[model samples]
Target: MSAGFSMHIFFTRFPLESQFGGAEVQTLSLMEGLKERGHHVAFLGSCPVLLEKCFALSVPYFDLNIGPPPVTKWHAISFLWRQFLMRKKLINAINEQPVTRNEQRVIFMLSLSEKLLLTTWAAQNKIPVFWIEHDSIGRWLRWNPWLPKLRRLSRLATTVAVSDMSKRMYLDLGWNPENTVVIPNGIDLRKFYKRQKILRSTTFHIGCVARLSPEKGVDILIKAVKNIPNIHLTIVGTGRDENCIRKLLEQSTLETHSNDEGQVYHLSPTTSVTILPSVPDIVSFYHSLDLFILPSRDHDPCPLAPIEAMACGIPTIMTDACGTAQYVENGKEAIVVPAGNTEVLHEAIKQTTLRTYEAASVQNTFSFERMIDRYELLFAHSAKL
Candidate 1:
């Protein structure tokens, strides 16, 4: 088993299948990188509209949905049950010996179902299974009934966590820290290149590219924008909270209020706030804005949007809870603020509007090429074993 050896990796979701936050981007980029290296790659899963839009022109991968229809959400009582059934299908695939690798090193993306199947098959066949954990264990262990199974899989497979925080949490939860690898998500520098000249905009635009979910703290940014004068906010991404955000903004504007402390909590209907639909061309959106902000309220493994914005030579303001905050230096590359603090977010946005900075200085450390090289090394090593 070596670098040139033919290996097949199974993805639970095609990188182009869903509009995922950071995990999907990283996984899809890795798949593309591996394909570029001439590895025989196959994707196995379904995708939603967001992913379809993002990767519409991407290379085609294998999709299992061509067979009989998969289990529906209406039939499954819990998320865990659906996951269990999906893995059962994959387990059958392995038992049937559909795909084969001479020096088998199986990699499983974020699918817990695939993780279990690979672990079980690996234990029986002496094949190595690598489990890529994209989210925090703390977040999943709370409601998921599969923690015990995850622990078992962790012991059998090489667990790859995207951030140090996520890896530490897994270790705290009694996972074998030795088998875990912390591979921080990297930005795709080629795609996210900064524009030579900033796009001319009528207003000082503060933009964010994130799922409109509560954890992302889009509302916090909205509240912060209320304090900044003459600043317009553009939020990208859609989620379950989209309706809630629309309602909140609509109601806030209708409330007649002056600039008192309560005014921050209450929105005057007269305020100018624009909510735009998600766009396929995020690069253009990042370039069109004067500044980028990440106002996440909860801990995230690592976010690629802030790093990508910085790569495009756009300065960013990210909250402390963002795992990628480690890459930013205050007053140099980006402005770091505490999560859920509207005042800090407001001041950060205000300061960015008044600053003149060079994006090249901050974009050196994050690049897609560098990330691909790291994965190539990891995959090579895995195949050798």
Candidate 2:
């Protein structure tokens, strides 16, 4: 096994044709990094968009037409039947290239069933398999009846967690700690660079890029900014709670105006809350903000938003629930607050607005080169086994 070994990366839920998120970006960047390091990298998935992107990058890719998982009983049965067909397609794709024993490896980020199927195939063929866990342990691993079988299959593969928190969760869920590796997600510094800090505007612009969902705590952000003067919040991305969040904002505005008691609230007419659907110009979105916030209520495994903001030279306020908070100092790189505490978040926002921080202090820690080097080490080690 060497640094130039061939790697086959597999992801079942790659949403290439639709809106891509942090996970997609991380995966693509990793592939590019490996390619740049002179390794032969190939992607195997069902996403047409992914295939298209791979083609554009001149990377080898195979499409298995593995659409979204089945939701109904009838569809589940059909999916099982199609699974057999997909297995054949996958085998043929892998067999297309014959390499030395230590020159081939499989990297998978897949659903439980797909993982089990592929790992079994890999093991039978004496190929090393690595599983990257992008999420914390959840009911899927705890309550599923396939746990015993999945655990057995997992023993034959190396598991890579995205963060230390995620690794701990897997260990708590009975995954073998020795076989699990923690690899933090990295950002492409070239795509997100620090811009010249602009002078303060008449109204401060606080922006967030996240799905409008309960777990993301966008409502908490809205509530925190309600009475704050001259601070406008821009929320980007759409989700199931879009309508609900809009209604909450509208009602809050109505209530505030009605209770003004003939006194001006100090909130400027243009100082408003804006919700945007997903946009392609995310780098521009980060560059337009005076500050960025990630008010997650749930334990986000490893959020890329704050890191991206840091790279853009925008100070960020992220809740303690974000795993990336480990890399940030309270008053240095970012303002870390307790999750779900609106009052604390409000105060943190006010405090951060009074100060400026250096993005270079934290940007180097999450560079794509460092992340790639670590992955290369892990892959090379796995290949030797």
Candidate 3:
């Protein structure tokens, strides 16, 4: 059966236009596919530009909240305080605002307050709410006070994790296994998998599309690149670790040109390393890459970049920290390495580059359509009251 159910889906906060990450892009793509399949979908969140883009795809949305202003501090303290306040205010704001009873609202949340509001509202009103689990599992467990509330509401709603790792996380926390489903992120095949004339370049354009955070393990990738000569690395996405990454990149460059590795490690960057900001031309981004690397130090539930890269016909090198790595074969679709190990990461990159894997073989099992189809089935089955 197609996604033709007569239902309305309300996603709480969709990062419709933020070029910084993949969650919003996946959400927008899913909404578009759902609309095409005859489901009525709408969103309530910040990112007006992204919201409008989704609307243009015939997925109507309402911007009901605004994100907190960007700040400079990258420490855990900054994240905790800001996230705490943001969630608190958002809960108060959304709670005060009235929503219609007829709407089948699925509150999208990046913070505790949003989760609380949606969970509470869904339980109180008997709405069939679904939590689209994003971010790391550790982050969810970090907030001690909310654990009881989550457990209490666990029976009231169905939770959908983007990856198997995320599903395991909920189960590990004693969440109802019957109430949880694993629906991975998808890609727009028509756009990202289009036929394009290939351009040949000497410098292997190895691309990484992720936030420049320490947890992302970009430094590991850089170290690997230094070991492998004559390749340029392109990092996409912005975050708190920009300065640290720049310094690391400079040191790697110095190491690359220097005779000694130790001497190459000490030099600092005079200018910020030129990192290309997030872009809308994801099709081009994927098309231009020889390899896509996800070097995350923490276990990322289901990262879209690797999947998207495969869809775009580019081979990938992913770490075991990525939950989606389980979906891939070691020597087939993509290579998986230990998290934070530069040696393994470097070897994986070298091997993939040397013996280029067939793009069709890598993409055959992991299409965006397949991922969406799984979600459609899960949603239909779980929507039962």
Using lDDT as the measure, name the better of candidate 2 and candidate 3.
2
* lDDT by candidate, in order shown: 0.66, 0.72, 0.66
Top of the candidates by lDDT:
2
TM-score of 2: 0.84
Clashing pairs in model 2, backbone N/Cα/C closer than 3 A: none
lDDT of prediction 3? 0.66
Residue 167's C-alpha lDDT in candidate 1? 77
Q: Write the per-residue lDDT of candidate 1 for residues 1-385, one digit (tens) a residue.
A: 2266665665554221245566777777777766677665555555553245335636544444422222233322344445566556666654543555463445565655455445776667766677777754443454455666668668877777776767777787778987888777776666777677745656677788888878899988888777555566677777779899877776667443333212222343323555555666888888877888889888777888888788777778888888777656777778889988998777777667534345453345456666666666777776556
What candidate 2 gets wrong by more than 4 Å, as runs, is 1-18, 67-89, 96-102, 254-271, 359-364
What TM-scores do the predictions have? 0.82, 0.84, 0.78
Worst 10 residues of 2 by lDDT: 258-267
Q: lDDT score, residue 332, model 3?
A: 75
lDDT of 2 at 89: 65
What order do you get sorting by TM-score, best first? 2, 1, 3
Evaluated at residue 247, the lDDT of candidate 2 is: 81
Runs with alpha carbons beyond 4 Å of true place in candidate 3: 1-4, 14-19, 47-59, 65-111, 194-201, 255-274, 359-365
